[model samples]
Target: MSESYDVSYPGVRVWCRDESGSSSLVVWRSQWTPEVIRIETPTIYNRTVWTVGQARVLRDVLDAAVRCAGGGSW
Candidate 1:
């Protein structure tokens, strides 16, 4: 589903998950300065699976995004 940059969704986590040779990652709260610390994944994602923490963050971010887009957060 993500061989390249997915324009379908505009989020950093998703983007980071799909980037190539991206053995490590850092989820920024905002696109601002060097203020946020990054969380390292157990393994690099090749569009295959998600680590427990990664999956959790993904679900939460997607849910919030969906709600903010006007759909209910439930």
Candidate 2:
């Protein structure tokens, strides 16, 4: 099987990647952009997840899907 991440805009749609390897987002997609993000701050027991910015462009588009799905709000 294969996987995909379909990124898009109001009047535009783009597929950024097709095939790839897997690793922590910190390695590749680092430092965060306007996109919704999962920040795992190191803790004694586990990691804390969070969102960094409030971008109106794709506010509820990409990463927001996780938060809206009750996957820990930022």
Candidate 3:
């Protein structure tokens, strides 16, 4: 099994390994950034940063998706 966080959007899947200890560091990637999967393994990895605003936007979008999909806990 892989140790990573994942989320599915309308037509996309985003994921990233949980390697950081900081609460603010959320590195994620999707089909558009294949390098995230190509380079990262259980022992080695890379990260792409998202700004606070970007992260918040993602959070909001995900919340909306969940709401539309019959409302689930976030």
Model 1 per-residue lDDT tens digits across residues 1-74: 32442212222352243344544343333234233323444354423334446657876997798878998623
RMSD of 2: 16.0
Q: After superposition, which runs of candidate 2 have C-alpha atoms over 4 Å from their true positions? A: 1-18, 23-55
Give residue 45's error in model 2 in angstroms: 39
> Which one wins by TM-score: 1 or 2?
1
Model 1 / residue 25 / CA error / Å:
23
Computed on alpha carbons, the lDDT of every model, listed in order, comes to: 0.45, 0.36, 0.47
Q: Residue by residue across 1-74, what tens digits does model 3's lDDT show?
A: 43445532222233444565322223345566433322122333434345556667766997798889897643
Best by TM-score: 3
TM-score of each: 0.34, 0.22, 0.37
Regions more than 4 Å wrong, model 3: 1-46
User: On TM-score, who's better, 1 or 3?
Assistant: 3
Full-model lDDT, candidate 3:
0.47
lDDT for each residue of candidate 2 in 1-74, tens digit (9 for 90 to 100)? 32343322211232233235332222112333434443332233333334444333344675578667777533
The alpha-carbon lDDT assigned to residue 15 of candidate 3 equals 46
Kindly give the stretch of ten consecutive residues in candidate 1 with the minimal lDDT sum: 2-11
